[model samples]
Target: MEHSKLSLARRLKLQQLAIFEKVVETGSILAASRALHMTQPAVSKSVHELEAQFGESLFTRGKRGVKLTEFGVLLQRHAQSLLADLRFLADDVNAWSNGVSGQVVVGVLISASARLLPRAVVRMHETAPNVIVTVRVGSNDVLFPELARGVVDVVVGLLPDNQAEGTSGNLTHVPLYDETLCAVVARDHPLAGDPSIDPHQLENMAWIVPTQESAAWRSADAFFEAAGLVAPKRLVESVSILTNLELLLESSMVALMPHAVAEQFVRSGLLSILPLRLASSFGKVGYTLYAERTPTAATQRLLQTLHEVGESVRLELIANSPSTETR
Candidate 1:
């Protein structure tokens, strides 16, 4: 059995795997051939060789395109990881021979993107100026799967609350600090300067709330219930920070925002934190990575920077936002 494994490994080639991956991505052998700049017959031949070695059909053919069978779906997952690692390997080697220069792709949610990540990037430039930092902004639903698939080096935001829905228990979350969620509105809103807030007053106002699947939504729901308020009916359900900001500025919609995010806009005089505080609802902000993957040096440097910036942000939030004492 060991000999068979070795023989099969010898027969399989990286080019063949690359072709197979492109086919999976494009969903059509002809599209893969065009993308790879190879002849249609050549691309088909490589895929056939891969299928022969595996002894199972990877894709089922149809006139429009091809669809992955169960085996194909499994292989595609591993194939993507392998290719991403190879790219990182090349970058690592190049950086080693030269000065520090490589790419680190980070997935950031709204909480971290507003302050933590930008601060870290600036700090990283002070040390590893040549390191290329790319940021992909999205929610956990989009970022977590990318982290598992090795498409993102790290994710910086609120850590999941023991819920491993899409990741299948392969992620490692490193807690950096905790920040409270605050009720926010445009600086000129009627509730902006109120010294005392009433929970019932907010129920009639149009509000911006997170989608039900998010951790923030769960916390918000609980906070509202504890305050003896019914869920607002005049609602816009969204998790987009930019969209929420625009809606808040243009209309009188209130949003539950992380303290770190709210503080930045508050200083700029664009938004105000309502006196109504969610003292118990705090998000544990951190970075997450795939447990099995070894981060390249560039990624490790960025992680260290995140830790430094995270500490500073944590301290700043405590000194500035008084409501955190309750959390």
Candidate 2:
């Protein structure tokens, strides 16, 4: 007689499910037993229980360790997510009872990080000192993958111009504002004092290019091509914002930067914005989040803080902007 299709979601206990996840993670029941502080027999019993409930073997044990069965891999993914939700649920309930405090990891792109990110971090620290915030700086190519993999809690940066404005699938991108790009150079650079230079004039100059993975490079290339100028053949690919600024400060090399970030340097006598038209503009700077998963209390609070800061930055960009129109 054939048995009914396996449905671990319907009949499995969370405790046993949790134990199975640990076993798969640790690679063997014996190792998992040590991690969980249970005996080897107890760990074995939990795995056996899972297999019996699902009507399949969850693991094929070898002398060295164990490997997940097809069903085991499928179960592990769902179990890990469910267990994570349960953890967030526990943290949420406890936070309501206790004071606000938890950990949040944010992946931030460099341009916005300098202006808005610190404001959000400062607010978080002042309100909830117990909440730990880790910010990893990267481009969309690097950070968006982390968000999809459940490695990053949230991603804050400029979204690609190609992406439609809205949530799609498991990802949600929110537009904060459009940050304009400007070509800048050191205060002493020859073009620094030029009132206006056409795009063709900059064709042969060395450029501080962003990494190929970054979307900024695409904009830079497009802007030059749009103006009938060949994109710079001589370039320095750098990822760090600091390095870009320093290079621009010490050399004749030109770099494209967010107007918000470039504004201060221009005021400080460190850099000068070349009055050149960029046919292509920097896209909207914003944040992306995992829509399916629930955000923790700390995450929610941080997002609220970011929203406040984002608004201020948007206003500042508008007020200080020389151009009245957006691309």
Candidate 3:
């Protein structure tokens, strides 16, 4: 779910969502009204008004009760995520008001999904139980713009080469660790039987390609170029991580994944590393911010946890992947 879109400020108001949810849960305006300690007519009017605003019939009522129409089902997931955010906002407003007990939105990347973000989030929660977190995961092509727009407080991922220190920008970066690109295939893949596979074999195989603008894709392109070979011509372009993972699991498609991300899946026997190393280097891996303003106490605490987690991850990578080194 893209919780960023679920922010009530973008669309429906909080009260409307609350009323809409009650009707959905109780199956009828009368039942919802009783549950909410309001009159049945008021509940009915609210539902009718919302349905009119949406310009669609959200429910179908019958003797057996009510059922959601197609549009209603489509909005169900968004509603849940949206309502949760609203409640999170309410909790934040009622907190100590020291800014340490509110919601914080963090933009994440697939590279950090398997390890970095989760570890930092757990540690953050341990200290600030009242703090709520909403993580928005995407490639730098998508996340950095959001960070620049102030929609995201911080981005946790490998800094794109164009945004590096020597390059000009208002963004502030903290390099937490380093990682390298590696190839992965299904556990039961034909090449999985051999610890070492020739890089040229990738040319003949299908590939789950990342967006051309993404750092992962650029890294893979550079790697293939350095090997004096054309990158796999048979490409499946999908920005979704799980979709690519599923394709790798069930098909002959080879995929490029950061060593940190691929390590967990490889260790669990869900995927196999190609045992191929690359000379193409990735830039510093860490959080990037818009630098114009200071983060709240809650967000700063989370950033602190991320730095700590990054140190542990960096040491772990050096001990595990021989070719990886910090910048």
Q: Which candidate is the best by lDDT?
A: 1
Clashes, model 2? 0
Residue-level lDDT tens digits of model 2 in 1-327: 344436545677889988898898899998999999999999899889878876888899899899999989888877766775676676587678765777777998866777777888898788888887888888887777667665578898777774555887788888787887777899999988887677778888998866777877787676666668776788898868889988887789998787777876877889888777553567788888888877788888888988898899999888766454221
Per-prediction TM-score to the true structure, in the order listed: 0.81, 0.70, 0.68
Best by TM-score: 1
Candidate 3 lDDT at 186 equals 92
Worst-scoring 10-residue span by lDDT in model 2: 1-10
lDDT, candidates in the order shown: 0.84, 0.79, 0.75
Look at candidate 1 and tell me the lDDT of residue 200. Answer: 83
Off by over 4 Å in 2: 1-94, 162-165, 267-269, 277-279, 324-327
Clashes of each: 0, 0, 0
RMSD to the hidden true structure, all candidates: 4.3, 6.0, 8.1
- Residues 1-327, model 3: lDDT tens digits: 233545535655667768888888888877888999999888888777777657788889899777899998776656766665555455446454654477677898777878898899999888787777888988887777766655567888877763454323767877788777767789998887675556787778888766777766677677677656687778887657688889998898888777788788877889887766554455568888777656656678788999899999988877767354221
- Evaluated against the true structure, the overall lDDT of model 3 is 0.75
Q: Which regions of candidate 3 fall more than 4 Å away from where they truly are?
A: 1-100, 162-168, 322-327
